[model samples]
Target: MAHDHAHNAPPSETAMRVKALETLLTEKGLLDPAAIDALVETYETKIGPRNGAKVVARAWTDPDYKARLLEDGSAAIAELGFSGVQGEDMIVVENTDEVHNMVVCTLCSCYPWPTLGLPPIWFKSAPYRARSVIDPRGVLAEFGVELSDDVEIRVWDSNAELRYLVLPQRPAGTDELSEDELAALVTRDSMIGTALAEAPAG
Candidate 1:
């Protein structure tokens, strides 16, 4: 039996170049290597969409918490111990059958990183920023989310001062799910409004 070595190949040229650039910046004291590492660790562990997922799950399970979340996203999210620069001012929009809400940063990727983790490259791409506002339905269609003709689609453009997060509708048959299990069904794209929450696995 032969093993595949494709996965063991050296880093791509672009990756190597990026690594070299980072090394140069670190050596020149232009960048704080420790800070970069800490940021990466934060995203990978402490700060991520899981925070938002937990919030969403709680809201789905507790009506009062849901009301509080919808009334004041920043404060409600703070109640969950998630607060930071990018998330100082936040708004959470709910997705309903009659109204589907989407969020985008037209100027730049002004995302709620504390709760939503890092924004994906597509979220920051010029195409997404421009199209998400111009033709939100088309953009959602591109992502394979087809809404009924009667369902109103509202596109929220985030800015430096404030950010928006989507509270996707809870999937059915998950009434018995534990908080952690419910969180596991959430995805980064779902929180970003690019996709729906994962349906419960049978």
Candidate 2:
């Protein structure tokens, strides 16, 4: 699969793309550091975790919506107005006692960044990409998540056309908790299905 074009292409071509974007942004007065920081802060606080919490809360309280989320994550998530940008084509995978799901980007890190914010540096690492598929149990062990031998592991390799998210099982003792409180219990890893949300101790 080696391509002569990649080997022969000038490195300056990649650099030029960045240079051109920087030039355009600068000329349009859109590269202000303060404005960029404000935008990042607004999204990081307002949209990303809010979406996760909403999904988790619904799954905890509504059986019908939970079924819909498990069957069609994009449509279920769209119910909360969480779509577009990186979330345009989202898929939600649910983990059960018999089957466990894990996601990785074998080709590139195609992720639901709108709902999950940015992909962590570790997610974009070559080690994670290779190990998650080849040694999923080992990777999960590193994350302190041990699976039973009876459970079958399925690794999803994300493509540009589709993205995957995990819908972790809700914790117990949260039956009376409000949606906002339930949201607080949903963690980033839980949404990825690697970890389960824990109910707060009274």
Alpha carbon lDDT at 193, candidate 1 = 90
lDDT of each model, Cα atoms only?
0.89, 0.79
In model 1, the Cα lDDT at residue 165 comes to 85
The local lDDT score (0 to 100) that residue 132 gets in candidate 1 is 94
Could you estimate the TM-score for every candidate? 0.84, 0.79
Worst 10 residues of 1 by lDDT: 1-10
lDDT of 1 at 43: 82
1-202 in candidate 2: lDDT tens per residue? 3588888777697899977897799789888767867887967786675576688788878889988887888888889878877788888887777888887887788778766777777778898888998999998888888998899988888866788887776777887888889888988777765666766878
Best by lDDT: 1
RMSD of 1: 3.2
Output the number of the TM-score-best candidate.
1
